[model samples]
Target: MAEVKSMFRDILSKQLPVEDITTMVLRKPKLLPLKSLTLEKLKKMHQAVQETTHQQEMVEKEQQQITH
Candidate 1:
C-alpha cells in the first residue's frame, strides 16, 4: 500500500539502519496500520527518534569520558 511505502520512506529518511527497521517492523506488527498516516505525524515521529538517539549518544559519550 501507498501508506506503507510512505512510512518506510519516512523511516529510511531518518537514517535508521535497515536491519533495525526490519527487526522493529517484524516485532511490532502494529507499527504499520491500515489507516493512512499523515506527513505531520511521520515528521513528529522522526524528530522524536532523532532526539532520543542524540540524548543516548550524549550519555554514552559522557560515560566514556568519565571512564577515560
Candidate 2:
C-alpha cells in the first residue's frame, strides 16, 4: 500500500503544475498594408489626370454646343 501510494503521488506530481504563473501581453494589431507608398501616389495622380481630362472634355462639348 505504501509503495502504491508513493507511486500514485509521483505520477500525480509529474502531471500537475505547481505555482506556474505567466502573464501574456496582447499587442495592438496594425494594418497589413497591401499598397506601396509609390503605388498609392501613382494611383492618386492617375485619378486626378482622368478627372481633369473628363472636365476638359465636358467644357469643350459645352463650347462646341454654344458655337453651333
Candidate 3:
C-alpha cells in the first residue's frame, strides 16, 4: 500500500510540471510634443476631397432616379 501511494505521487508530479513562467519586459511609449503643420494641412485636404466625391455621387443618384 505504501509503495502504491509513492508511485501515484510520482505520476501526479510528472503529469503536472512545476516551473516559473517567463515575464514580458515592460515598456513606456514615447510621447509626441507637437503635430506637424504639413500633415495637418494634408489631412484637411483629404477630408475636402472625400466630401466632394460624396456630393457628386448623391447628385448622380438623384439624376438617375429622375431619368428612370
Q: Write the per-residue lDDT of candidate 3 for residues 7-50, one digit (tens) a residue.
A: 99999877734443355667998888586889899999999999
Model 2 residue 4 CA deviation in Å: 49
Better of 2 and 3 by TM-score: 2
lDDT for each candidate structure: 0.86, 0.91, 0.88
Query: What is the lDDT for 32 in model 2?
Result: 79
Off by over 4 Å in 2: 1-30
Candidate 1 Cα outliers beyond 4 Å, as residue runs: 1-37
| Highest lDDT scorer | 2
TM-score of 2: 0.55
lDDT of 1 by residue, 1-68 (tens): 99999999998798966787676333644566655668768988999999999999999999999999
TM-score of each: 0.46, 0.55, 0.50
Residue 18 C-alpha lDDT in model 3 = 48
C-alpha root-mean-square deviation, each candidate: 26.0, 8.0, 13.3
lDDT value, candidate 1, whole model: 0.86
